[model samples]
Target: MKIVLIGGSTSSMTVAARLRRLHADWEIIVYQKESYVSFGACGLPYYLGKHFDDYQRMLVRSIEDFAKANIQIKPSTKVTKIDPNKKTIYFETSDGQQNTDTYDQLFIGVGAEPVMPKIPGIEAPNVFPFTRLEDAFGLKKLLPKVKKVSIIGSGFIGLETVEALGNLGYEISLIEAQPRLMARVFDQEMTELIDEELSLKNIRVFNNDSLVEIVTDDQGQAIKLKLASGQEVETDAVIMAIGIRPATHFLKNTDLEMINNGALVVDRRGSTNLKDIWSCGDCATSLNRVTGKNDYLALATVARKFAKVVANNMSGLKTQYAGQLQTAIIKVFDLECARTGLSEAEAKAYGYDFKSLIIKDKDRTDYVKHQKPLTLKVIMDKKSQTLIGAQIVGYNSAILRIDALIPLIWSRTKVDNELEQLDLPYAPPFSRPVDIINIALSKLAASLEEG
Candidate 1:
């Protein structure tokens, strides 16, 4: 059996690795548009910040490694079109050489692309949409000569880039069209805390203002930005991290089912509507475990899990993905934040009668030196009395406790006296008298009873 995978993203590589292990005799081929494959895109900001000198450290595996397993790795090859009915794919090489290849099974993991908004002077040489490794490399080369940088959008990538570049001693101006930073991920209260952290770091943030135009110099380099709020600021360069949309335009007009943003719709088994065709990654829709609906979460975690499921199903081992909670974690300056499941707005939109409570407390006992504050917010279904969502923000490893709460939310565990008495470990250096999660659950229970 001949299998072909498009795009050398985390999901594509994962599917290839697992499939090769399961079916060694089958022919496997991967077409990658970039020169490098299996590199962690998430580490781009850190690498650009000089946290790691060697770019090779970001690569999980090399082309030679995949080739050793008998998988054909075609780097710098772009798959322009796929004919599902004919079971053939047409691609163009870097040299403009076009070719056709047939496959018994095809996996499309083209991933997502950064949203490039239409604004005057957006094509400036100094303006870049921070997405690919090449973008990071280019930014690193430019940062030495650049004094100030403005970042558009305040999502994970935007925030990370701000911190990364800020650490390098560059003046940063973070512009977000929304009223708050990370509006989609964190609640208003949590965002307030993040806003404070950013302010402390001297990162100028402009919110509720959209970029109306990009002012560039004669050299076609972004120099300033005109905001819709009648504000203008001089900037040395601009990084656009507005958002991403699924990179599935090539599959347009095909019978394959897709979401509004072109993310391929697939079942729990990672099988698309078309037979012998599977897709997983940022390019495909994922099942949101909490909502029991398909969602397009452009996260590496979802892509990796779906990759294995697709590989197993193709190897005759029936398997199912357990969906996702949109779980995500981010580090902004010194504050670490994590959230799982839905936010308050999402819960309300889903028509769930839910109650949420935010608790502020010390992460550890006062006896511990340098103890920091932590915040925990828990959302529980009013009818079911179970956790539907949770968000945590704090310093040190306090935010990581979200790991323990994930199971409660995933299992839909009911909030009760027994759950409140969960035997979480406690230490002066670690936690307070009662774990923050337990305390938050206890508060949630109390609120539920009063209602």
Candidate 2:
């Protein structure tokens, strides 16, 4: 069997490795546009913050390693088009040589590209987009000369960049077009905690405002930023962390089905609309376990799982993806936040009759040396009394509790007296006898009963 994979994203590499292990004699080839393969772009922010010196640490596997496994990797090769009907793919080599390859099965895991806003002076030399390895290297090289740094967007990447730069003692300002940080992911009450954390760290936040123009000097370097609210922020550098869209423009002319954002719509088996063609990773949509809808989940966790499912199904194992909760966690300064399943906004949008509550409690016993306040919010479907969503924000590993809630949401476990009595491990230094999860569950149970 001949299998061809596009892009070097985590999903593609995972499928390649798994397929090689499953069938040693099968021909496997990966065509990647970038020079490096299996690069973890998530670590770019931490790398820029001096968390690690060697950039090679970001690579999951080297080209030589894949070569040893009898898997061919064509680096700096751009896949221009895919003719599903002919079962052929057209591509350009590193030296600009056009070529074609026939494959029995093809996987498109091209991933996504950073969305660069069409604002004036966006092309300034001092402006960078935090998406790829080169962006991190460029910004890290210029960090010593940069003092005041402005970041546009407050999504995961943007806030993480703020934390990375703020840790280096750089004066940082965050700009978000939304009313609150991570507005799409968290509720207003949850975002208030993030707002407090940013203020405590002395980071300036410009909410409900967006960058209108990047004021640059004559040398084409960013000097300041003009906002839509007539606010001007003086900065030496700008990092555009605005989200990303699937990099599937090359497939626009193809007959494959895609979402509004260009992400290929795939089923639980990771099969695309066309036969023998599959897609996963940031380039495809996956099933939302809670909502039962195909959602564009660009999370690495989803990509890793989807890759395994796709490879297994292709290998005749008939595996199906178990769906995802969009589970995510992040830390900024002293604050750590984690969430899984649906948010209140998502639950409402999905037309679920859900009841939500937030409980503020202590993480540990009063005798503990460092007991911090923990806040947990849970959304429960009123009819079924099952947890549909959960969010946690606090210090001292409070976010870790989100893991316990994941199974509850994934299994659609009812939030009743039995769940309220869940046997979560507890000690004075770790947590109270009644963990915050239990407290939230207890409240949710009461709400369900009252209705």
Candidate 3:
């Protein structure tokens, strides 16, 4: 059997590698639009911050290595069309040559593209989008020459780029259309902590403002950003870190099922509405474990896990993926923030009556050293008495303790007296007699009992 994959991203490469090991005899081919494949796009910020010098280190695998496994990788190629009836795919080669290929099964993992906001003079030379490897190379070349940069949007990439460029002595102006930073992922209280950290690092924040236009100099380089609030902020360049939409524009006018945002909708096994065709990645939609419905949670963790499920089903193994809780973590200067499952807003929107407990305590014993203030928030469904979501903000090591609570939420474990007394490991050097998680659970349990 022949398997053809479109878009050689994390999901595509993972499926290819797994399939190669499972079915040595099956023919596999990958068509990638970019010159590089199997590279970590997430590491771009670190690369920009000089955390690492070599750009080649971002690569996970080389073409020559995959060739040894009999996987044909066609870089600089685009899959233009798909005819599910004939199981045929039409692609354009790097040399501008049209080609056709047949596949027993096809996987779509085209991923997403950075949002280009609608604003006048945005096409100026100094404005850039920090998404791909090529973008990283271009930014690296320009970073030393520029002193001031205005980043539009305060989401993950936007905030990360702020730290990366700020570390290099660049005066950063972080502009956000929302009133609070990272509104989608963090609550107001957590966002306040992030804002404080950014202030300490000399990053200027402009919230509740929209970029109406990009004012350019005579040389056609971005000079300043005109905001809707009647403010013109001077800058050397701009980074469009607003957001991203699925890169499945080529799949339009076809019968393939997709979400409103153009992300392909697939089942738990990674099967789309059409037979013999599947999709998984940022370009596709997966189930939200907490909501129990299809959601477009575009994280590298989700892409990696569901890719295996797609490979298994295509390899004749019956595999099913449970879904995702949208677990994510990030570091901003001295503060480390992470969250899993649902948020208070999400729980309420999903029509669940929930109670949330916020706790502030010390991470470790006084004599143990490195004792930092830790803040944890837990959301529980009042009716079910089960954990629905959790968020943490604290020191580098302290915030990562959210790992223990994530599994409980993922499993929808009930928060009762028994759970409050969970036998978690404890040592003065690592945690208090009652760990932070246990304290949060105990507090939550007490609230439930008070009813």
By TM-score, how accurate is candidate 1? 0.98
Residue range 1-451, candidate 1, lDDT tens digits: 9999999999999999999999889999999999988878789878877888998898999999999999999999999999988999999999999999999999998899999988899989889888888888788788889899999999998999899999989999999999999999999999999999999999999999999999988888888999999999899989999999999998897899998999999999999999999999999998999989998899998999889999999888999999999999999989999999899989998999998999999999998898999999889989989999989999997899999999998998889878898888888899988888888878887887788
**Which ranges of candidate 3 are over 4 A from the true structure?**
none
Off by over 4 Å in 2: none
Residues 186-236, model 3: lDDT tens digits: 777788989999999989899999999999888898898899899989998
TM-score of each: 0.98, 0.98, 0.98
Instruction: List per-prediction Cα lDDT, in the order shown.
Output: 0.92, 0.92, 0.90
Alpha carbon deviation, residue 130, candidate 1 (Å): 1.2
Put down candidate 2 lDDT per residue, 306-417, tens digits, no spaces. Answer: 9999999999899889999989998988998998999999988889998888889988999879889999998999888899999999998878999899999999898887
Rate residue 40 of model 3 by lDDT. Answer: 80
RMSD of each: 1.0, 1.0, 1.2
Better of 2 and 3 by lDDT: 2
